[model samples]
Target chain A: MMGSLSGRYAIVGVGTSRFGKLQGVSTMGFTLEAAKQAIEDAGLSRDQVDGVLVMMPAIMGEQHGWAARVAAYLGVEPTFSATMDLGGATACGSVQTAMAAIDAGYCHTVLCCFATQNWPQGVAMQLFGSEFQVPYGDVGAICLMAHIKRRQQYDYGYPDELYGQIAVTWRQHAQLNPEAQMRKPMSLDDYMRSRWVAEPLRLFDCCPNTDGGGACIVTSAERARDLAKPVVRILGAGQSHSSEIIHPRGAEQRSLGGTKAATMAFGMAGLTPSDLDVAQIYDAFTPRVVHDLVAYGICASEEVPEFVTRGNLTFAGRLPSNTAGGLLSEGHLSGFGHIREGVRQIRGECGDRQVADAQVCLVTGYGGAPHEAPPTVSYSALILAR
Target chain B: MFAIEKPLPRANEDTAPYWAAAHKGELRLQRCDDCGHVRFPPSALCPRCLSQHHEWVKLSGRATVFSWIVVHQSQHPAFNGDTPYNVTIVELEEGPRMHTHIVDCPNDQIRIGMPVEVVFDRVNDEVTLPKFRPAKSK
Candidate 1:
């Protein structure tokens, strides 16, 4: 049963704390700042928000029960609350949950917030590594994706240079935005000459460790129409899981769960890949973007190389993606960056990197390395319309 | 006995047998008695049939590199001296996969689908690691 949630709820306000190394603030501080800003930006008082969805900050070893903590900090008696821990995928998942809850009349105004303190604190091992993975020196995030990309290169005959192209595009996109962390212009030569963090996956190929938070206020469409900002409708939401195998023992380098999630999201929205005017896709790694592009049916696996080469991901390009620079250059607020970027693009609030006439924006979040449960890895997609 | 200071696997209730076999210099995998499906990283239930009844069976040790990554940097202090090591996932001949390192081969020469065979290394009295080297024969 494909139950459509098209136009049932909308994101009335979006706010983010300063990205990059947030040294002075704790996770709670960042979350509170973003949450309050989001509520105010929606033209709603804290009392109006009767529901809250929070992403637990694990990078700082933050304790759980974040929903209750955040609710108490904000002094709101929420009717509905939840704490999501899907790694980087938490933001999109929270948005999906908030939309469903509002549609079900659980609550009218809900605040979805997430904060990350992974900047100085390296969480590569704690976040992705399992018992089997940690002991074997497969602890780094770059190592895991590098292994995956190596397999992709072996089977698909795709050159590693394709990843270089992706890195270059994001660096260029980041250079235009003042909020971007790494604004240095990256030429293909610069990308090639960069040191390898893991073989075949160079330094530039990985997203910088980030510390920040972002929050969005989701409300019913009728109530959102009376808010402060232009309403961006939550057209569809979906999530899926692929192989639990961290190292899939096969030649196939594609992602199954991501594709399933994308398909479900498009199906629920009654939209196609072409209907998307912009994509705020997760780019923790360049290869991830490639796999996600194929999984979302934006292009076939075999055609990824040519597709990436021909279609620029910049604001001036055909299918603009991650116009706010993405995780590569933008501070990794986890998936919150992607979701907030989608909202901003649809609202035409992005100053220089905004995609023109973007009516429908696709936002996806992916995280975790594979394990027995694929425990941490999750894929969540949101299709938003202006 | 040489000191084995590196990180070693601490076998739990389900994985003790797999480790015991490794201590005996033998490679074993869990096979579901119900569905006859084999799996690695020994678990309580079979991935295929979800049956708890399983047996630890010996493997041929013959495998091929499914994928590999060279670690130029490491967060673990034990691997500080081995920064340029190669970690690989090899598909065993018995249709199961294991995480081990590819040794006796240059980092530059390691290729995907390259044939390899297991070489057990007793790191400590309590632990023995299963590593892979270029296979002499298929």
Candidate 2:
């Protein structure tokens, strides 16, 4: 149902540092490492870098990001620069914009970067906490999902351990990922023992606040085809937003929106979920795995827990998902690591967990409304087939 | 006028009636004419059918404790005094859910499917945000 563009652009190089608390490291420094590594990996020099696109969550309440600071450090002021203002979501769009610029001849070599120090802001710091917390009840990140998780348990007769397996399995996947933040392996017993952040959502169900950076280089496919070693082509890229605010109260928000954004993104990819060899979805919470899958039509509505139990999401299974431990385990640098893992799965670098002959992969970006059922559900979908 | 006024979280055009009525101490929601579906975060258009037809209707002010969380801390500068608050998503009798705080009950005692009734707390003279309390009195 989807077709590819005829040689628009390709990713020539990719770079990333370990995802964790990078206290001693400045975001600029992290961004620089990824940039240099990407340039070197692309077999291109700093001089060859003509354009730069950066995605970093705002630090210190300041609206700007690391693009200009990075360009200054690289000593090669770029001809084009943009700081993705959206939280962690810019990672996906940053790469998409680079490919577009390279394709449109806006620049020859485009470097995309993202760096973050999310935990320092206090994992407790989130906009929804301010906008929605009404002097009591569920507040912070877990409040938004608690209703649904609890409802799934009661209304649908699901088990309490439903969440345990998800949190445990993903962290298990992270154990294999050297750069993953939560490296300690977890068991269902350990998961259940962990105190609840909100009812039904344990502390382990959340994504970690990590400091890290990842960069990818996009250039003309002509240059890509001539590159040394293996290069993963940017087969397709798509992005969308669901009005940056929650629908007004009494807006039929229950019809389950934010899914529309996924529809537009997957359409842009010209591919369906069935075509994906692996997917790195932005799972800030566990149910989000269910949300993204059903929204994208990868699985039937309400089929998430069953699918997980059947093991379709396993590394050895049909739909290898979150092999880089996902946001639940690997830590969230705004979904950049998800992209890095997407690139890896396509390159077949995942080792023991690698899907055999995996050709195409999908990665999503989530940034949207704070109080809605799925706050910040913005997404970017990519199709990569080697 | 000289004092910093506490902002009363009022619903605007999307939720103006709900807030407007809440000003008069009535809980309200907008019903969609197209899909016959009730919604929260009031909108002039139906999210399901995308039809620009809706009507403001007063609610039963009745709901169930479909799900909730006991907030251990408050991040908002406005809510620093509130700790261990219960942020609840009550499934209203009309069918959709509303994110509100549950007052007048011990935090530990919050149970799923518990019956709850609306309670309005006046932040000031103009706004009174809707919260809930245990329908059964202590």
Candidate 3:
């Protein structure tokens, strides 16, 4: 946790369901598994929960209906229920909301859940026209990044090998996580050689469509002291929105780093890049992590490929990032996996790959693409501390 | 000889030059007088310095196919007839990546960083789309 959010809220319990193609299981099944596990981890009954927050990118579900359904299934109707519909940008926002509610005495115990099953074809969420992309239904991030890469390569000579390095780094971390999706070790050779999906980005450079669920039970700091596990407090939070188009008005000024969101959260948490013990930057694409690291001022923009190439983000490196394998390796539940990793890092339960004494974590989420410039739509960031 | 069923990006103050350039078979970009940063899909203000002072410099018609997608489906009826068409996003060497179509290139040989050059295709009296072909052949 950053010093700013040092004592705001503590995460007493966290849980994740297996991430893969569960063709027969309903979304409710996955949600219940994660919720039950989280409640068990917290040693709390469903009856004790006072609030519920449903986390999702886009309008996958309407009106927090899914949260109410999950609560009903769990046999514990939370006194308060809300949904974080900020696209993939709400990963950290969802967690922060529950924390804020807990702090403000809106709810004593809050249960947050996110389950994503929509795959390959995507969901039915419409901020714009689904018909616009119907001709080529695959017009989301792949095209978004492809456009950016095309421009970057046209001028900067950004090599394809840079994308490979990002894949290899996250897979290296995933190899250590038993629950990760792409646990198999990936190499630069394999990455470069993989079948191309778009012009600049290969299949491996993009995250796979995986089905999964994640949940966490949040409680007051004082109540957390009585729990069996250590409490990870919420330190800071921030978020920002961009125009709907691919390149917004001032795109050249903004990279996909999502600086506005990250800074807002960091400032609120009273922390800087150096204060973090670990980072779980939002990564729907391999390039996203690189851009976010620079945009968040974790390092210089031009030095990103070099930094990643130096193994600084590897499991054993001095500066470890995406220790949970990220969306690339651990499976992207949109951004749910991002939040779960942050909680795990703060919990000190990440086993051999865990950053030693990781007390502060920076987690970010991204939604939409560069409408005017490079990155568009909503984003949020949070600093979690133990 | 067609109709656009979906909404086009409609010419705006920032994008009018690009459309006008395509109309003339000339690829033009805005170079910011403030910082000398050249960009494509023209804009009112410079992205690098936000300076409004600039000029519309026509491109040399020389660029590389930075990357491309062989779009298997066409979302717009304007493109429905051209199923399995290629959408090319090329690096202008001039510092802008313009989204266009690729012509006169075999799909099998369209590798990353493949050299290519720009060409203009007049769809109707009102629209002229910029496209690319193999640099060697052009």
Candidate 4:
């Protein structure tokens, strides 16, 4: 019965603002630009969109009733609206929430969008427990990610060069993407020589904060068929959150909440990992790509080091991933770029970065405060097909 | 030159007891009376059994280093002078992992599975943080 819901809804249109450092664009300005582009991309007027879901940027400081505010700004009074907070997972989560609303007949078309004016804020510092974590100087997501990388090194003994290889591969893809932020060619040496943000996690390993926004219009499959763009069916969607205050003893240390989510998504789609033509795994950090590759069943844990080092994630590799350079090379829209890339890839619209014969694509989003010991990490997955 | 004040941990009702025990130079955790599960950053009920009846139990201050990171970048101004300090996670013998600093150990020497023992750092009159150092030979 659960599988029956697969492919009932589709992403009819996707849009993104110019990504990179910019002057004078407010947060709502980016949102309105992306939303307007998406609405136009779908060949629909503002009045046609009856639902809105918004994810506020973490650095901007959250606002109350943000979804309603976004709706009001757009001159759209959405009947089904909500503001979602899942961190990086919010983009994919918003899409899934839109699908749910459309399935329940609450509304026909839903607009999901996120945008922010980039600034150098310690977004993760205040999230640590004031008593336990803050006192110990455990601030920032990079520190927590460094701990996970250290743990992985101890357990799997993978070479540190594996991370460098992943970084270089994504950067190479970025060079082909005109809109990518850091399009300069990066060599493995450049990656190794990069300054450390936290030991084992270097500057290149972290995604650059940029001013950007992304929006997508989701509607029922039947309605999408009439839209201007090709209907990219939502074959499967799954989300999993592991809220642990501290890393649980005897639990798999490397299991970062993606396995269960992949199981559910792939199950709903009646497909397997090998069937995917492309993937857009979240790349907040380079090691995250490795962890998600293993966690999503794309490859076994032991095989990931060699799989990534041997260029399996490149556009010409067996499984082309993050074709538009991902959050690492592409501008960070907090996984919204991943969603837009997935939709565009399925529609065969990407000029140079497009994968040949791409029919199925997978997009994943991950975010949370790892220091919270609720180690509250959330994973969201979407399987989009032509 | 004026020294910047470091941020202190704010304790709530659920975690007040843990801070109080640390102030007294003793390591304590909440153990569920029903399932005997010990938890830290204390919660109101047992996660394993959802039992509200729990006791404040003293612990062996012994732990093993689970993972660690050296700070090359400080997010807060107060930590600017402590560049390249080590923040560690140590798993207690009783099965709870915690975030603390591993004192008196060089950042490069810190390794996973290193044996450690807790030491209290009294930052102020009210707050005493539980830290760790390399364990001496038993």
Descending-TM-score candidate ranking: 4, 1, 2, 3
Error of 1 at A191 (Å): 0.6
DockQ of each: 0.56, 0.27, 0.11, 0.75
The superposed Cα distance between candidate 1 and the true structure at residue A113, in angstroms, equals: 1.5
Cα lDDT, model 2, residue A244: 22
**For model 3, how does the per-residue alpha-carbon lDDT over A1-386 read when each residue is reduced to its tens digit?**
33434465777777877678766555677778888888888888778988888764342534347667777888876778876667677667777777767666788898878777653234453434321132222255666665556555554566888778888888988888888888887889999888756555678878877777888787877888888777877777777776422333344434553778777777777778889888887888876776678778888767766777788887666578888788899887767677677888888888888788888988888875443333356777877888
Q: Candidates sorted by lDDT, descending order?
A: 4, 1, 3, 2
Task: Give the per-residue lDDT digits (tens) of candidate 2, residues A281-385.
Answer: 778887667666776678775676787767777776778788878888888767767777777777777787787888888777776435544245456666666
Per-residue lDDT of model 1, residues A1-386, tens digit only: 54556877899888888767767667888888888888888899888999999987766565778888999999999999998877678888888888878768898888999887654344343443555665677765666678768867876888867988888888888887888888988888898898888787888888887777899888888888888899999888889755533424356423455878998899989999989899988889888898788889888888888888875666666689988788987868787778888998899988787788999999999875443322346888999998
The alpha-carbon RMSD values of the candidates against the true structure, listed in the order shown, are 2.9, 5.2, 6.6, 2.1
- Report, for every candidate in turn, its global Cα lDDT versus the true structure: 0.81, 0.69, 0.71, 0.86
My TM-score estimates for the predictions, one after another, are: 0.94, 0.80, 0.74, 0.96
> For this target, which candidate reaches the highest DockQ against the unseen true structure?
4
Clashes per candidate, residues 3 or more apart or on different chains? 0, 21, 26, 7
Q: In model 3, what lDDT does residue A124 have?
A: 50
Q: Global CA lDDT of candidate 4, please?
A: 0.86
lDDT of 3 by residue, B1-138 (tens): 546553343567776777778778998878887788886546677766879899888877777665566644343355556656566656666756555666787765776577778788775787666777878654
Better of 1 and 3 by DockQ: 1
Give the number of the best model, judged by TM-score: 4
Question: Model 2, residue A381: displacement in angstroms?
Answer: 1.6
* CAPRI verdict (incorrect, acceptable, medium, high) for model 4: medium
Number of the candidate with higher DockQ, 2 or 4: 4
Predicted candidate 4 versus true structure: per-residue lDDT over A68-89, tens digit per residue: 8999999998889998888889
